[model samples]
Target chain A: MTTFRQFMSSSSLSTVKDAGTSAIDSLKKAKSDPSKPPRYSAAGLLVKGAKSEEWPRVWREHDLKKSYDVVIIGGGVHGLATAYYLATNHGITNVAVLDKAYLGSGGSGRNTAIVRSNYLTPEGVAFYDRSLSLYNTMSSDLNLNVMFSERGHMTLAHTDSALRTMRWRAEVNKLQNINSSVIDPQEVKKLAPSLDVSPNTRYPIQGALYHPPGGTIRHDAVVWGYARGADHRGVEMHQQTEVLDIMVEGGEGPDGKGRGGKVTGVKTNRGDISAPIVVNCTAGWATLISDMAGVKLPINTHPLQAAVTEPVKVFLPTVVVSGSLHVYVSQTDRGELVFGASVDPFATYSMKGSLEFTEELAGHVLELMPNIGRMRLLRQWAGLCDMTPDYSPVMGFTPVEGFLCDVGWGTYGFKAGPVSGEQMAECIATQAVPKLIAPFELARFERGDLVGEKGAAAVGH
Target chain B: MFGTRSFSFSFERSALMMLVPCPHCGPRNNSDLRYVGESHARPDPNAVTPEEWRAYLYWEDNPAGSLRETWYCRAGCRQYFTVTRNTATNEFENHPLPGNKTGAVDPSFHYVSSSVSPSVPTTSNAAQETETNS
Candidate 1:
């Protein structure tokens, strides 16, 4: 059913949008309309995509040729996603996906799993919007359930300046045909009915930029589904096969293009594998791989943290983010509350979770949801984010011929995985950058073309 | 230009000595931030002695006048703000150095806050100017 707040925001009634009618009407329309054919979730696809249950976790050259048409580095979600898109979309089946560890064992598994498109910059908003739309049907498209949830996401504004930014954002989102709007205090109250909105406050939450279309999903499902689907399409998956360095010799290495400085193949632990193209999909370690190829990027690495609580009665039905509070929390299907926060000031490669972060988040979240003060936090974890100053990912062709760049995923990488892979593959196969992928070039930094997205990307859910 | 800082050259400072704040950060003693009272005065580049130039870089008169000057909040705020302190009674007004438009009042915006005219003293200048005018 259309949420009451959504009906109120729908303006067909008389004037501009009203919160109550828009919320209710949207909910009602959704209820009346039937959903399309269901997509295969990752779990569902696991049974159908794999051969029973016994693919060796780590496969080496002893079993296969240890070589292929294309070699993708890093087995993390981005790398696998790139591999999946190449195989399924581009018909490049001679591709091999390699990871230092297990699939989805990196940042992808460590995220809060929240997804949204309520971004500030047009470049950012448009890019993320496309990803969200793709994720909406990722399950059906892959014939597996990634358990894609379409609940809702909200970003609360705590100051007049922040509220003004929300209004500005609402206008920008409308320009992009997105469903985000600047909600008032009353509307925010209805959406998160149990929140404490005290007026006598520091950083008082005056309103929010409500994105009813945004929500959280399962992170692990993305890795499994992509891997299984890619494998089914004749792509090889290799785990624990750390690529030490890439070997590019005589005339532009593999894919055979650039100043005869081609990449011949990668020097991996198992053995030497020759590939026509080597796509780097490593997130935190993208710069390392780039250096191996003599390609430099504007990418720097920073780690982001997230935590979850044990199952509680379903107190939260939507994702909540207080940008001012710098805290976000949501109740998972298992009744556990998943929480995530922004990256710390400095950059580091360490994955060790910090006690200070959890304590800060708990204090902020407790201020909003006072009743949930007694709940105990179960586990906390950290993930490395390949953050760019502009908060946008870099994709498509680089200075190197056979070496394509898809680094700089950062925390938003999980939500953009499928779309990122699809576009990067298109860029490679077409020999021309896709319109959607062209704006995120690694060279945009030097040319003074920064898409500042800090205002819209906090807690990421 | 978030990391950008600006420097301003005053046409009035050479003729009438000026008072400016210490750019360095210091303690609660306030005086821990010393002022180089009447240095930076310039004769034409060719006319002055190297010692005269040295004195410009090192000396002071902290003279009194309708003199342009710099003022520092040596006691309270640690910011390096400049002000015009009348040397007569050590009575002076403070203003940020110019060209840093975003942080300083724009002579161009003389229209909006007419209450703060170009002729008026800054917050630091207001009391002393009021006392002098009285």
Candidate 2:
């Protein structure tokens, strides 16, 4: 049997003498006198402006401690929001969020910022509806203007099969107390005068699933708000801190490969930080991060490309999506039309934008609205998505003790960020999976109890 | 508000357009092929447990670096073959040739003869021609 000293030396954690003792003392001191960040309000802004005083930084930087009670990998919206909720709801402030890059550098800022809860499954609809409600009051709760625009969202159905699926989704959404309905082509054209409802088009609009509560929000502001809130509550946010490997102790894993073990700590580039619990919130690198803990996840990374056009007059009033065409479009507050498509045809981690994506997107956008032919695309980019076989996320506890995963959030991760963070925070605090997210357990795949959401989540984001 | 200015449409060449090379057919666009994700060894059905069976069906070794995957030439030859591709850079290595069948077959893949069309030139004919020439 390998001794603890021998295991530490075998790994890259030999430099540390005592892992959590000194850090726990410092964390206790920080908890005793938690310094709150300055609040954002119109009165406070005017006072600062009148006094000619510079505003303080949104979040302060801190030195990496030797240990934390909870270590959340990935500093995106989900991780930051989890940290925020953990501090506020559970009063667990000894949490650290680590990121390989700056906060919101991943899918959090890369998504098209569309938020809706009209889903095909009851569980999916209920979960995402909670997220939408959180987003509705986020401006006052976070003291940051997320700039949420509740412009109605419309998902067009081009074929009879697609219309039937939309009706099914509408029924499911209604049963869950969500405001969704199936509208005809006349209603779709009335809602958005820009769309072509004529019969001469290649894919004529049959009907649409319209959700009046859906719209877009400022994605960066959401990330910043969560980071600021978490920091104010004594949660540490470490940027450019990459986790190299995870240290696990006993328990025989599946296939006897030593996977089902207790997570002791994670080794990073800076040094080894021992923590009792580690949460994997990384989207594109979900499988890789979990694999470091000897936990295999059913996830494949694929790049989803999105493009934005030059600023023009705001012609689109509502968010329009076409599942048959595999494209979704909405005009931002700046009048720039943001467009996103389905995940790429294959699994890849590369975020490099492809010419084929822009070409296909342009053709489809013009097919839906031929009047926008003169609109030139300003820029295009891609974000990595962790796609699962069932098109839903995998949350809650794994076989490995103290290693929780909130991943497998394919194309629709951004919309579910707030609720995922809330549920995951409750799970960490209570040491049990919450009832809302219990259906998304990693063991569901083994039991063939997958929550299939492909019809609503494919290109509907 | 339509202007009379002629629109000169041109995109930068930096954007990637994947070109896949098939052994039977020459180079074709990636759209012409169906991407089968990372290949895995199938365990025996009779002996495999439910956990192992589900893991085999869903789990993937989705590395950011070089990965060996299978692709089907749907538009060209309609044949399934394996190739090593770099997921990060979108680069391919060890391009399969017509006569060379040494490293192409994966241990998990079972070769089916009925899938191949007789009208198309088979790899055996190309190997026989190389043997005669040599």
Candidate 3:
């Protein structure tokens, strides 16, 4: 089930380690260098960094582009995060974050923020676990409570093959020192308590795959924290600055210029702004932005939707996932039940929620937890997702000079807000892309070396 | 073990004389999830001769007694599970087997191999972390 990181208490996180009893030490260990890496059973280790400042009123400016060392296109979490990481980690001062809309108003804001490290592939489990580890201490490091919850994550399997696949995944997770286990029907009842797993069904509650270090996070705080940090480090954040057309002078290799002149810059609604470096963090609109630069991106623009229900007494304590059901649900901090499902079958730019989705979601959720039938939905909305065939984000450099991309995050971009931004910043400052982000390069798709993250990326939690 | 050919088992004939291993979810009342008589299994791939191939393909035994056959829970579990069905009575029962229990039914009603695991820990917690599911 799709869930918000609303109820991932620190106490629940402590359960995976020395048995979830005390998290004070874990929290402390997270803030400083531990004798051992932050002992996260999720998937990877956690490293805490300092909190950054906010970009106040950066969203309302209608002014055009100003010159900068690096100008990142897209003011969402990834753009802001890229700015924050560039300023704090790399110390490259003159950076600008441009957004077409208000900050965090895109997929980054509309997503159901659940973070977990339970992945089937080694590369996947390792990468996401690192992000989960960072999230644990992100609030403190950023000096804000991003509400890093480590409640736990569960993947319920109905069929025996599905259950066996769960078992296989659990074993692989354990081999990496990631905590995951097999649970039977009785255990499933104890974890969710409200799940309907009558063994008499076709796909009975044979087992579940559990990750103790899995949980949720606050999506807005992540955007805010990075923006604040980047702003503090003298990064100019320009919101509502829509790039109308990109002017790339035709040239040879990275030295091409248009109209027999050197490369100029982008013409935004506000005015023309020239910059050497432009990072496409436009997210769902990434393809459009890339096309402006005369580059064809390996991404398809698709819309993903999520919804919330009127706040009720908080009943969901942990994040739940049903791969078979294709429905993931969790209750938010203020008691609103958050629901998310796979992207609609068709790809469009519209954000209108559909009734067909509501019917399908209600049916699946009711089957899992029959008791919540009394609740009513509060609202539903959709966001654009630049999807890739392999389901991995398109990061790193492009064929165009000074143009970088942090787009094509699919639906899992929200939870990876901090990490992706942090890494993108490093790439910008050093002018050297990190190898970790190397696997997700646009070149991978062309070369067929794509790092397939479909196993861990389907649910954006 | 997963990429092999087809399997066989005792199939219960419904009131309409349908078979047992048809693909109907338990709740679907009107679906033809079964067929009358028993499903057949192929001979060992290691065996030689056209006769062996024919025997594995179309041969059958009429031991309508406690018949032991290969059962594929396609619609239900989508996994290969062992089951003992009374040939004469056409009753179905499921049992776990070690490795690939292709035809070990007549001699053994229980899990007869050493590979049936009690608690082999995997990386991803099969969610059944507690003892109740065991």
Highest-scoring model, TM-score: 2
TM-score of each: 0.67, 0.85, 0.65
What residue runs in model 1 are displaced by over 4 Å at the alpha carbon? A1-66, A250-260, A459-461, B1-134
Cα lDDT tens digits for candidate 3, B1-134:
32122112122111111124222222121112321122345457686565555334322232323344443444554433233444323333332233423322333332112231111111221221111000
Candidate 2 chain B has its poorest 10 consecutive residues by lDDT at B125-134
Clashing pairs in 2: none
Per-residue lDDT of A222-269 in model 3, one digit per residue for the tens? 887776666656777777677777767764424353222333577787
Every candidate's fraction of true contacts kept comes to 0.00, 0.54, 0.00
Q: Which sequence of candidate numbers ranks them by TM-score, best first?
A: 2, 1, 3
What DockQ does each listed candidate score? 0.01, 0.24, 0.01
The sequence of per-residue lDDT tens digits that candidate 1 reaches over residues A229-303 is: 776567788877778778766545443333446777888778888886898988767766776776656554556
Query: Against the true structure, what is model 3's DockQ?
Result: 0.01
The candidate that wins on lDDT is: 2
What is the i-RMS of every prediction? 24.7, 12.4, 24.8
Per-residue CA lDDT of candidate 2, range A1-461, in tens? 99988887876352232333343344346456557545565445544555676666788888889999999999999999999999999999999999988999999999999999998889999999999999999999998999999998999999998899999999999889999999999999999999999999999999999999999999999999999989988999999899988888885854232456888899998889999999999989898888788888888888888999999988899999998787899999999999988777777776767677898899989999999999999999988899888889999999889899999999888999999999999999999899999999998988989898887864642
